[model samples]
Target chain A: MNIGSLLGAIGQGFIWGIMTLGIYITYKILNVSDLTVDGSFATGGAVFAVTALSNIHPTICLFIAMFVGGICGLVTGILHTKFKIPAILAGILTQLGLYSVNLRILGDKANISVAPVSTNITFLANVLNIPHTRAGMLLGIIISIMCILLLYFLLGTEFGASIRATGNNEKMIRALGVNTDNIKLFGIILSNMLIGLSGALLVQMNKYADVGMGKGAIVYGLASIVIGEVFFRRFSNFGIKLMSSVFGCIVFFIIRAFVISLGLKANDMQLLSATIVVIALAMPIFKENINIRKVGKINSLNEMKQVSSSDEIVKEKIEKREVTEVGGGNNA
Target chain B: MLKLKNIYKTFNSGTINEKRALDDINLVLNDGDFVTVIGGNGAGKSTLQNVISGTIMPDFGTVEINGINITKYPEHKRAKYIGRVFQDPMLGTASDMWIEENLALAIKRGENRSAFKWMIDNNNSLFFKEQVAKLGLGLEDRLKTKVKLLSGGQRQAITLLMSTLKKPDLLMLDEHTAALDPKTASLVLNLTDEIVKTSNITTLMITHNMRDALNYGNRLIMMDQGRIIFDVAGDEKKKLTVEDLLQKFNTTKDAPSDAMILG
Candidate 1:
């Protein structure tokens, strides 16, 4: 990739990093494979576009988007916890419902584009007088760092400890006097809030919000997390694990940029990303299976060698006994 | 103090699989009473504890702790007054968590968990180290180690420590040492004796081992077919022999099983 393209990829990666962080909470901390991101991400963008059109401050629109995204999470949480719906199904239900919600927020439009001279432009670009791409990159770095610190602090608290414990062992945490349902709800809400914020930032960066903006978003988030884990597997520090998501996202976007330059169609990228995630997730299991087969082969070979050696010893002993019998007969 | 009055539970009601787990069960435990429960399989020993701990609600009963009716309380809500360790060591702890983190959760068992308050601080870390040192397993320095890495015996010991850390109103041990080897089981039993004596906490322990049921607690009760057939305490309990108990069992029901006699 050229220098400019690489920089652009990094910038987009940072913005997506916020979404990855949200996925991390549900996927890692809450131990729930929440599929609400695709809907919540678009909800965020839709909220941002509608509010910005009404002349709300662009920065304030970010928080508004987050609030709306969190509502989307609340719906999923209630469905999963209270209505007894399976987690994945609950998330799918929300994602499905958000389709019409997003359209309504966009005034029945399929997409909405920010004018080139509109105030919907991000504060970093306006205040710093920098190029749009550079502003996004800087903003992403600043916001991601702030998010990392906040999460680090939050996870260290008593409530955060219970959330982690709930993810680790639901029964144990419940037995310890924690209402696991409440903790799960809080986790889902917080996760989607961050995802919503990421969506708002992306809408501002691309200067447009489309109804299908968040298609395949969950796979992207999972890929970022899986790739991040491969890099930070050895580190038990919570902060380092969170940072790995951003780094992974940056690498993922860089790879995408390079593949696009190689003449790959954008339509084919979804299949490619899904395949990458599947391979990454299955890597450890594959290694374990291979090791087990190797050990099994060696063990069987050893058993066969022992059986053959013992047979030879028994035959040699019988031969010696026969010779002794013949020699004794001659003495007689 | 704990009370279970008129407790009745029937599993698979009205079906061929229907079985009465607890039938008209009534139990009352005074403060600091350590009661050892002994019974064979399907004898309602575990069902009684489960009823008290809110794992399953009785079809008909009023469960009370210190005069407060908790029959309708959920398991997590009842946990404010109850502490439990399961037969399976894995059920008692979050294996992936650090030793200190687990202990921190235990220490706040009945307290409000604040969002902004730090779970582990320097002061609490030192306290946890001291508490772990008392286990005498050389685990004081390994506070950062995950609980999954510990042996079954070690995990049970930690679980025991956690259950009693907050001085819960009632402690329930459902065959806590049944999963450990004999040596580890005896060690854990001894530790249990020491902790109960030191803290004077009210406890209910269920076990199949007759000798253990006789040896450790202040009182002993035998259950058969969802009923407490025999209850003994004070000098009568202290002076009773294994032979006397077996003879009592022979008269009350069938002859004692070989496992019960050997135990």
Candidate 2:
């Protein structure tokens, strides 16, 4: 790939990498398929774009977008935990609701493009004396790296262990005196906050936010997690998993770029992403079956050992009997 | 002490499949009381334990632990005062977690703080090792091993240790040894008896083995349908035999199911 193309792909990958962290929290840590990601992404973009357009500081706008996204996640958590709705359906319901909320945040427009010179990227580029695209790329990398570090620290905290425990075994955690419902709410909110931040960053990078930007976002996140786990098998630690997810997102984008270079159509990208996720999830199951077959072979070996040992004992007993019979005959 | 007064629990309350799981259950357990519960299938043994542990809300009743009415407390809330062991070895502890990690969580049960850091003090580890060492299963040296690698009986033994570590006011055992082989089951049972006697904690255990019911506890309770049909304690419980239990089972209006009898 050309240098410019490579930089562009890497920049986009960084943004998705942050989003993948959010996805990892919900999908891997909480073990919940949170479909609210799509709408929450748009929600972040819309909130950030509108707020920034109104002369708010970009940082403030970013925080606002994250807060909005967290609220969306909270709603999903409440619906699932309190109302007893299925988790997947709860996510779908929230995603659908956010569609209209996002539109309202964007003044009913499907797209919001900031003035070219006044856009967040241009403002940063002018301040730093760099090209807007390069500035955007640098900004994406910094934000993604910061997110990964913060998440890594959080997951190591006592509350984080409880959250991980909640996903790993809710019953055990509950029996340990943790109110897992609260933990679920906390996890979902945190996940969507990261997702929203990713959207906010994406809009600044592209100089515009569109309602359709979040489509297939969940699939992208899942694909990144799967790819990261596959690539980084030795890092089973929680921190490593977080970092791998970020790397997975970056790798995914680079792969996409390569696919484009190979003359693949843009329409086929989603198809390829879905296929990758399916294959990645099936890897462990496939590995397990192979391991089971190996175990069967080892078990047969153990059986043989037992058989030989028993035969030796029997032979020893028979020899003793022969000795006793010879002694009795000699005495006679 | 723990008390249950006139507790009633019915499943599928208005439908044709409605079944009474617990009926007018009344019992009083003093401090350090170790009681073994025995019944055929659907005899409300587990249901009674669930009710006391706050896993299920009784349709009508009162439960008091140490003179505190906990009838309305949620399951997680009641966990502070009650420790439980399930029949499935995998249910009581996280299989993927290290043995010490699981113990750490249990040790901190009912504490308000989170247990994120693995920087357990040497003193704490020494204490834990002492507790685990009591099982005589060599688990003190295997504290870092993931619990999933342990055998069912070993896991159950570890779970028993973990549960008694906190010395909750009431300990509930729900057929905890039913899943093991005979040898392993006896091993776990021996550990259970030792832990209960040494801790002097009030405990209620459910077991399908009639002999185990007669042998383990100072008191033995037999349930039929949703209510206790017989409760024998002290010297009388020690003198009871499997034949005596079989006679008691026959006299109850609700016949014991085949699974309960065979089990």
Q: Which candidate has the top score in TM-score?
A: 1
Candidate 1 local lDDT, B1-263, one digit each (tens): 89889999999999999999988888888899899998777888888988888888999989999999999999999889998989999888888889999999999996899889999999999999999999999999999999988889999999999998888899899999889998999999998989888999898999878888889888888887788888888788898788877777776554566778776
lDDT of each: 0.87, 0.85
Across B51-76, the per-residue lDDT of candidate 2 in tens digits comes to 99888999999999999999999888
- The reply for model 1, stretches above 4 Å from the true place, is A116-121, A299-332, B247-262
iRMSD, per candidate, in listed order: 9.1, 8.2
Looking at model 1 chain B, report the run of 10 residues with the lowest lDDT sum.
Answer: B250-259
TM-scores of all candidate predictions against the true structure = 0.92, 0.88
lDDT of 1: 0.87
In candidate 1, position A187 carries an lDDT of: 90
Give the TM-score comparing model 2 with the true structure, all chains together: 0.88
DockQ of 2: 0.31
Error of 2 at B4 (Å): 0.4
DockQ of all candidate complexes? 0.54, 0.31
| Candidate 1 lDDT over residue span A1-332, tens digit each | 69998999999999999999999999999999889999999999989988987888777888899999999999999998889799899999999999999999999999998654254345667788988899889988888889988998998899889999999999888989999998898899999999999998898888889999999999988898888888888898989999999888888888889998899976677887899899997875585556545644555565646775555554454456556555554343
Fnat computed for model 2: 0.55
Report model 1's TM-score to 2 decimal places.
0.92
